[model samples]
Target: MLDFINRVLGRESGGSKEIAKERLRLVLVHDRASVSPQLLQALKTDLIQVISKYMDIDEKAMEVTLDSNERQVALVASIPVKSMKRATRTPAVSI
Candidate 1:
């Protein structure tokens, strides 16, 4: 990808350096949170199961990542919903 090429060539755009720094920070935050890849996968699976009860989602397109700042770590999910299901016994999630 273009990003790989740019990194290989040591070419940093005006904001790419900051973006790289933020990525490194996120890695450190994940380490501090003790969130392993397996744990993240497990969480993603749980989210899919729970959310699927009320909506049809594109599992292949779903993304779940951890974002952090100086004070807190946040779970960020980008799930593509195909359609919403009718009201059922399962409670709907509120943002």
Candidate 2:
């Protein structure tokens, strides 16, 4: 994809070697960050809860993905905004 983009932009292709190097760079980033897919999912869930307090959100539409290079991992998340509404009123009961 990078090569194709470079070519389309009239830039020299980095070639397979450059592509491999780039992959390694990303992997290293991921490794150093310690952000794996599982971690990202947990982070996404927490984020949704925190953000939901102020606004509505579609939990199903939430996205938490990870990309890794040779030694690095990157965490990416996408959450859509939703309308906020109060739930039905309930009568209080003594414990």
Candidate 3:
């Protein structure tokens, strides 16, 4: 009832609690997945390799974790990029 009243009055009710609930939900889902730790680590390694093929990234600082809401699951990866290869511009050919 209080939440409904707050909503009607255009006030946010307990945003931090909601955020914490969502984060807890994600951690629970990740913890509950059936894959072995070794396999998950392998997957994370593969992710780093694939991403590093395109950009110079902070490999030592990368982190990969799983997350899920009620209906969807995701492999969340935090990769810090140190630098990116710039594309060289070709001289424009005038017709």
Q: Give the winner by lDDT.
A: 1
Q: What TM value does model 2 have? A: 0.43
Candidate 3 lDDT trough over 10 residues, lowest sum? 84-93
**Which ten-residue region of model 1 has the weakest summed lDDT?**
84-93
Collision count of model 3:
0
| Candidate 3 CA-lDDT value | 0.80
Tell me the tens digit of each residue's lDDT in model 1 across 6-92: 888998745767889888988988888888999999999999999998899999999998888768789999999999997767666
Deviating ranges (above 4 Å) for candidate 2: 1-32, 65-76, 84-95
TM-score of each: 0.71, 0.43, 0.59
Best by TM-score: 1
Clashing pairs in 3: none
Q: Write the per-residue lDDT of candidate 2 for residues 1-95, one digit (tens) a residue.
A: 88788889998774688889878876766676766768767788799888887678889998876666455455666777778557444536779
Instruction: Say which prediction, candidate 2 or candidate 3, comes out ahead on TM-score.
Output: 3
Q: Which stretches of candidate 1 lie over 4 Å from their true place?
A: 1-15, 88-95
Q: By lDDT, is 2 or 3 better?
A: 3
Per-residue lDDT over 1-54 for candidate 3, one digit per residue giving the tens place of the 0 to 100 score: 999999999998788998898888866886788656687789888988887766
